[model samples]
Structures are given as C-alpha cells and as structure tokens.
Target: MSTSTAEGRLLRYVDALQEAFAQEMARDESVFLFGLDVDDHKSIQGSTRGLLQEFGPERVFTTPLSEDAMTGMAIGAAMAGMRPIHVHIRMDFLLLCMNQLVNIAAKAHSMYGGSVKVPLVVRSMVGKSWGQGAQHSQALHSLFMHIPGLKIVAPSNAHDAKGCMIAAIRDDNPVLVMEHRLLYGTEAYVPEAPFEVRPGRARVVGPGDDITVVAISNMVPECLRARDLVAEVGISAEVIDPVWLQPLDIDSLLASARRTRRLLVADNAWLPCGASAEIIAAVLERAGPDAGIMVRRIGFAPVTCPPSPPLEAAFYPNPGTVASAIHAMVRPAAPAWQPDPERTRLSYQSSFCGPF
Candidate 1:
C-alpha cells in the first residue's frame, strides 16, 4: 500500500480515494470511517473495498440510514478528540442533516471559543447517474459554502481526489469533500505517500490567453474538452479548477479574467445564486467596470434534473454546450456554430453503470 518511487503510477479515482483512507487510518489510530453500506460487498462503488477487512469493524463499519443521527454522532466524536470520516452516498441526502452540520459542526469551534475542534470529513458524491433524477443527482455543495467554519472541496481528478481526502482528514475543521460520480472511473497519476492539496488554491488545468474558463468539480473535464474543441477555431481557453470552494482562490480567477477579459464559469449545479454566480460576481467586483471583463456561466438549466437519459443529457452542460457558449462570447459576430453531435453527447451517458 506504499511506494517509495519518485514517479507514482496511475490509479483510478476510486482506488486513489481508498488508498487515502487506508494510509490515513494507518497513520493515526483515531482516524475511522463509517457510513451506510460501507461494510457491504459493493463498498460504496468499491471506494471502501478492503477497508473493512484491513481496519476491522471498529475502525470501518456501517450505520443506520439516519443521516441526522449519524452526522450528530460524527460531530460528537470529532469534538471528543477522534477524527471521523462520514460518507454520504449522495449529496442529496445531506439535507437531512443540515441542523447537525450547519448549527453544530460548523459553529462548535467558534461557539466554544476555539477550545473545541471539529476534525471531521463528510464525503459525498454529486453529478448525474443512470436515471438518478432530481432526488439523487443534485449537487448542493453551494448551500454549505455560505456557512462559516466548514471547508468544502470538489476534486475533479484522481490526484486531487487522494490529496484532498488526506488534507480533509488532517484539517482541524469540518470539511466536505464532494466527489462527482462519473469521475470515479477516471484515472490520473498519483503518489503512494500521503500528500495534501491545501484548501483555497486553484489549478489552471488548461493554460491559454484568448479567454478564461473556470470549471468546477465535474465541469472541469467538460471544459477541458471544450477548450480542445475551441482550439480548432483559433480560440485559446485557460481553464481553472477551484478545488476548494468555500475558501475559493478568487485571486487566480481574477488574474486569468483580467488577462483574457472574457471569462465563463461552468459549475456542476444551477447558476442562480450558486457557485458559478458567486465566482462570476467575485471576478467582476475585483476587475471593476473599467476592466471590461465579460463574464458568463453555465450549469444545470435552472430546473430539476430529469430522470430520462435524453432529458438528463439536455439538463447538464456538455463539451458541445460549453464550447458553443465560449465561442459565442469570444466571436459574437461569427455565424452560429457548435461541435458535432457525436462529440457533444454526454460523456458518461454510455460508460456509467449505476444503481446507487
């Protein structure tokens, strides 16, 4: 489970997350993982596979389906000097524990005047799945961003998935790690040893000069593909992934927007008053009216996600949609155009097999 080589091997996103949990749990005795179906054969889409056998029931176990009660238990355990990682299979269900999360876990340290620490990590999955529909496919991380004392991160790749998981476990505050379901099958080179992707930092995934495309969570890969498509038309797009959402790296976003003067934010959720809107507002406020930075955003079409595959495909933003938006902003006078339908189809529509 450890490697000393300088060049780490490629690992799937799910395996990378499992490694993070295994390493951290071994490093500290207090680190433990608990969630519904964690001990089941499926192991939460195989991310928790082998944890039960390796860590035993005491450290890795399953819980009842009561999110509120389980979340409360985790908060209490964190206050009692143990680091707990609570996994919610879907972000949609987190709403059931808002009181425990917003009122207690997020406010404990401040309410206790810094004497108490809530070292807890809540891992949840977002994004569309096979006909999961509105109830199970919602990405509500933005709701938690408004609360104080909570750190939020949505790692889009395997590397950040592992690094951010380690960082969240080590952090002294309550942290929410939002994982995109489709990204679980993605692969990236990752180190065996534990590392931290510090919060409040943004990575420029694709560097360019013509325009800046700030993509969040699952949207990062789509925007990257859009960048490639736009390149055919002589457009260079600079894509940034704000790994940490609560303490967003607005400075990086502002710098890029200032350079390109045309920015588009693609998020995993709706745009109105969500992360995309927040990011666009931050950039505009700093850039000022004289900066002449034109901004736009794309996300779920401001409606409940449809259960049907075709409707779901239309609801979410794809590379074709993203590229079209970017093209429209950068070339307002150009004729209407879009990427090929085959290329624009939902990337995960065919690959993702899910019952969760």
Candidate 2:
C-alpha cells in the first residue's frame, strides 16, 4: 500500500482517476475493474494504465464489444458481494445497455426489499474529441438523471475526479461517474491517499453577488474563465459547479440564486429537458416565482453535434459565449459585447488530440 501524501501534489485528471482505481483495488480485494479495451495499450486514455499489470487478468480484464451482456455481468458481480467498476469508453455506447442499467441494476435493491445490494460504478467519458461527431460526442447524463435509483456525478477537476471516483466505488447503490474527455488533461492538487468527496455538494468556483452561474462538468472551467472575463466589465459573477447531477445540491444553488437574484445555468448538453432545465426548475420551484430571479440557460446549439471543426466550434459554448450571456442577463440595457475571440480561444479544442 502507498503511504498518504496528505500535503497533496499536482496531478492530471487522468492520473487522479488511475490513482483512485489503483488505491481502491489495493484496499479492497473484492473491488475489480473491467470494460471494453480497459486492459489494452491505450488503457482508456491512460486512466486504466498499470492497473491490469498490478491486479492481473482476473481483476482487470477487458470485455467484448457487448454493452448489455457486460453490464449484466457487472450487476451480477455487484449483487454477489463484489464491487465492480465497468468502464464505457464513450457514454454513447452506454445506450446499448439501458435495459440492464435502468431496469435491473437500478431497481434490484428496492425490488428485492433491500436484500440485494448492487454496488457498481460505471465510468464513461463525454464531450467532443477530435470531431467524433454526434454518435460519439454526446453527453447523455440527463437520461440517467431521469432514472430513480442511479446516482450521477460529473467531476470537473482532478481533485473532484479522484474524490468522486472513490466515493462512487464505496457507494452501495449504482453510481455513474461521467467524465468530460477534455478534462483528462487538466491538472489539480490531489492527495496521495484515498479520499471521497461526498455527493450532493456544490463547489463555488468564484464568489460574487451580482449573478449566479451554475456550470456542469466541462463548463465549470469555462464558466470560471467567464467569471474573470465578466469581472473586467464590473459584473461580479458567482460560478457554481454541481459536482453530482442526480442528487443536486439545490440548497446551495437556491441560496446563491436568492442572493444574486439572477441565475444562469451552463450545461455541457442541450438545454431542453437537460440538466440545466432541471436545475432552473428546481430553483424556481423551491424559491417560488415570487423570488424574482432572472434565469437563462446556455448549452449546445439545438442540433446534433457536427464533425467539422468550424461547425463543432459553433455547436459548443465557450468562455466568450458564457460571458456574453452573463452580460446580457446582468446588463441588458448596455450595448452588446463579447470577449475577443482571439484572446478567448477554447483551450480544450487546442489541447485535445484524440481518436478515443
């Protein structure tokens, strides 16, 4: 076992994920990981690197290209006193196993009257990666959020990524840890020891009183940058990252919205019936329409993701767009303005070189 480096050190998001898996498997023998290409040379973009060798084929083997069967296997393993981490290379593929996940794994505990425990972790990545197009780049977290028994989390940074992964593994119910591919390269300070970030908690990225910006997954960093950009124009934007999507931290969001009297939800997916809509609905329902909070949502354009770089650029939201939206909501009477594109070029587009 590795000693705890509680002082912490900077680790990339991918490294943090790998560390979490490594530590957890070492700590609990029953905890095993398996997924499509999980033991391959790429190792799910290096997140599963060194895991197969350390744990051997029995615990860290790869599955066939069958999502449904593999998911069933994971559920069966979980029910029989084992913690299984099933990795889906792309969240898009998870759709093929919806029945196993939503119908069986999700409902087994309640259906069996608490006698059966399905402690499972499904790790999947979302977002555009080298023009993967609509088929591969979709963020379908909202679909799982609609389900009753599953817990969904989309961690934005290395620290939260590691903590959330650990938490999901230890959770008794089935948990989905959605990772935005673009975040894998990002780095943050993480402790060497295992740690769990309690779910249903929201982290305030930037503090302000003017407006509340609730960003999901990859949008967290973009919104943080947007916060700084809006500051130049004298608009104080409070940015909040809802780390867990299922059990949303509505109280934190409502408190922030109540303070600012304005709320902007920026999600990685589309606006209609999405996480953003759910959040806005929750705040409005809880705070009441009498709260008089101004709300707006920004996400993917209402169309399928495009493969071309130019179309892809238009499809996704960036710091410039977020800042412009914030400006419109806070200073509606002011002249229309947006940050210079040259200065605010999307960082993920430039850094991501992927075929995974």
How do the predictions measure up, each by TM-score?
Answer: 0.96, 0.97
lDDT string for model 2 (1-356, tens) is 11122458999999999999999999999999999899999999999999999999999998888899999999999999999999988889999989999999999999999999999999999968477898888899999999989999999989989999999999999999999888999988898889988788888878899999999999998999899888998999999988999888999999999999999999999989999999999999999969999999999999999989899989999999999999999999999889978756667658778565
For 117-227, candidate 1 gives per-residue lDDT tens digits of: 999999999858588898889999889998998999999989999999999999999999999888998988899889988899898888899899999999988999999
RMSD of each: 2.9, 3.0
Q: Give the runs in model 2 whose Cα sits over 4 Å from its true position.
A: 1-7
Error of 2 at 59 (Å): 0.3
Query: Highest lDDT: which candidate?
Result: 2
Total clashing pairs for each candidate: 0, 0
